[model samples]
Target: MRFCVSLFWLLSISSLYGQTAREIVQAADSKMRGNTSQAQITIQTIRATWSREMTVKTWMKGTDLALILLQSPAKDKGIVYLKRKKEVWNWMPSLEKIIKLPPSMMSQSWMGTDFTNDDLVKESSVVNDYDHSIVGDTIIDDRNCYIIQMLPKPEAAVVWGKLLVCIDKKDFLELHTRFYDEDGSLVNTMNASDIKTMDGRLIPTRFEMIPAGKPNQKTVMVYKAVMFNRPLDDAFFTTEKMKILND
Candidate 1:
């Protein structure tokens, strides 16, 4: 009887640990992405000799739909990227063409930045496409955090082979993330900072992506303005909306 009780206890603890990891990931994802979100964002790409900055307007609804419209620099204006369900498309006003992005293109550089198309448009969901497990815990930026490791599901169309995320305990903010390639080599590191309240919620407004072995090269994204849980229509993510610059 004693042996059976101990075995049962061990199994129960194992199950609890697994459930807790998923719950933590779910909560953190929900905090960052509300039901609907609209934001004005600026992306700055820096290199050893040259630097470029661009502004964009973004709208996202749940995990199924996202639309991003370029808004600045005069030359790149009216460019748009839209992700609906599993499909991704890009609209180029200069060429008057809409290009459909394939799954293989998710790993390519996004606008010559350190971030990939998958990173910006979120083609694969971290909460749903990957299996989460708590590897350990640590302190980051003077805040206690839970270190979670994510492995992509077999059927999910994603670029990263592995992802390790450090999420703060108090606010569930994803403070740091390391992305790895299929060969187990580090590809990039993403750090989040400048937490502030926006739309009645606290979130990281500044994000930086640094590629491995790329000295003095990084991409910085800043959220200038953010609104969450706003009403958005399904038609907004269609290809027709991607060509409309005024809306």
Candidate 2:
């Protein structure tokens, strides 16, 4: 009986120690490591009678960094979204001007899309902005998942309190997410679906976000085109390219 008791204790310790800090970091790396060269982004709102689709040429090195050039639908051509660290900038074609987006406006609607400006552009946040933890094992969209809780390191920078992410076991592609308020109340829920092959990578091609307490209000994104892991030149990520693409 003494040997049986020792075996149980040993197994328990192994489980706890197995999920170490390094392992946690590795999981984060898996979650956001890759390149997306070009993508088609469409934003549709359920609460209103509106939708907009745009082709995007983009590049990224890590979370909280990278740039985007928007093309298509004529009027919105030559629009660029650039973010490095805390700063955000946009170049518009109609006026031929570069506009600086204030920090507070990040949460506002993104050019008439159902989602906010923040939602239209997804910047990887698990590393620099949030504290992460593996809450448990769960299933999402019939695939095994790792439930991770991400809370903003500084409460002031973001609008949500706690963010829950369901990462698909096979690939770290995020399957679902829920953003909570400071009081721990859920404020929004987003789901990834209609998965398809984009730029040789199989990913969820459709994204939907629904505001809590507002069932009629929801946002859906349908990818018309996506070229994953494509090589994009940094020189193309400029105000000049923004105008050229729009033109």
Candidate 3:
């Protein structure tokens, strides 16, 4: 009888921990992605020899729709990338053509930056595609954080083999994340800083993405302005609208 009681207690504890980890992740996600959002962002790519920069405007609704418009650099100006549901499309104003990105290209770099196409477009659902567990705890930027381990579901179409995400306990902000490849090798690290209130909500306004084994190369994205719940509809994410979107 004692053995049965102990077994039940252990199982209950395990279930409670699992629920807590998932809830933490969900709250952090909501903080980042509201019902609708718009932002002006600047991206800087730094290398040992040279650096490049570009500015963009972005709109997002829910988890399935997003549109990014390049606003600077004479050559790439007026270019747009749209994500509708699971499909991603690129519109080049110079060429007057729209290209649909294949699933194979999702793992490639986006616009010569350290971030992958999946990182920017976010076709994979972090909340649904992976199983979450609270591995431990850590301190990031002097903030206490919950270190959660995320492993992809066997049938989910995801690029990372495992992920260690450090979400701050006080505000549930994702302060740091480590992405590992299928071979269990650390592929990239993303760090968030510069916390400020944007559109009445606190958030990290700067993000740095650094690839493994490339100490001299990294990409930084800074959010210049942000607004949440800005009255967006599905029509705004269509291919036709992508071609015409401007600053």
In terms of lDDT, which candidate is strongest? Answer: 3
Reference-based TM-score of each model: 0.96, 0.77, 0.97
The C-alpha stretches of model 3 lying farther than 4 A from their native spots are: none
TM-score of 2: 0.77
How much lDDT does each candidate structure score?
Answer: 0.92, 0.66, 0.92
Order candidates by TM-score, high to low. 3, 1, 2
lDDT of 2: 0.66
Pick the winner on TM-score between candidates 2 and 3: 3
Error of 3 at 113 (Å): 0.3
Candidate scoring better on lDDT of 1 and 3: 3
Report the C-alpha lDDT of model 1 over 1-247, residue by residue, as the tens digit.
Answer: 9999999998998788777878888888888789999999999999999999999999999999999999888899999999998899999999999999999999999999999999999999888888888889999889899999989899987898999999999999998999999888999999999999998999999999999998999999999999999899998789988887545
Model 2, residue pairs in steric clash: 77-246, 78-242, 78-246
lDDT tens digits by residue: candidate 2, 1-247: 9999999998886666444422554453543335434555666656644445555655554454557666666776667887665667788766778787887787776766556666544533445567666677798778897887777776447756788888776766787889887899987788998877766667777888888887567878777776545565556555455456544
Candidate 3 global CA lDDT score: 0.92
Model 1, stretches more than 4 Å misplaced?
1-7
